[model samples]
Target: MAPRDGTPDATGAHQRTPGARELNAAARVFALLADPTRLHLVWLLSRAESDVSALAETVGAARPAVSQHLAKLRLGGLVESRKEGRRVVYSLPDGHMKRLVVEAISHADHQVTGEPWHD
Candidate 1:
């Protein structure tokens, strides 16, 4: 069983503690997520794959700005894009990433609503 504490559980035989490099990489991901525009784009991608125009319209940002954020996210491996004929659709490549984004937003909602935290 997993540990009740926040530390990684040791119950699994295949599990290994994260190294400094791994922790640094996670920190980088958090740094990228610190930006509101990028976070919004990620949140949108977590919902559905969207093209540049649609993403810009939905996020209420200019096309160039949204395209820039998407470019950065793509480079960081947080998202992936595929050519859908004339348009390129963007999506979160990993299910874990979707869950992470949703959880972060939910945490923020809890803070804003003054709700008690739960595991």
Candidate 2:
């Protein structure tokens, strides 16, 4: 079982080693997040679902740029969108993706702020 902190057990019974396919898939995810704007978009989505205009305003990018980033993210399976009237609201699909995005930003924060890391 996983520990309360979400780390795997020392016995290694709680996790399985990833295969090549899994590794490649994860690599693709990292590649998608490599862009700063895309990463910022994901970070915002992790907190709440929003539309193109809102995301564009918040990220301070042009609507077309944000739309392109969102399209890439959606195609990569990092996000999903649903139609609400005329607007398309986007959001992360699962808890794992949410945790991944949050943890990545947290790591960046620690690195930039020179803060100590915690388990």
lDDT of each: 0.88, 0.92
Stretches off by above 4 angstroms in model 2 are 1-14
Off by over 4 Å in 1: 1-15
Candidate 1 lands at a TM-score of 0.86
**Model 1 lDDT, residue 50, Cα:** 91
Q: After superposition, how far is residue 74 of candidate 2 from its true place, in Å?
A: 0.6
Give one digit per residue, the lDDT tens place, for model 1 in 42-94. 99989998999999998899999998999989998899999989999999998
In order of appearance, the predictions have TM-scores of 0.86, 0.88
Deviation in Å, model 1, residue 1 alpha carbon: 5.8
lDDT of 2: 0.92
Model 1 CA RMSD to the hidden true structure, in angstroms: 3.9
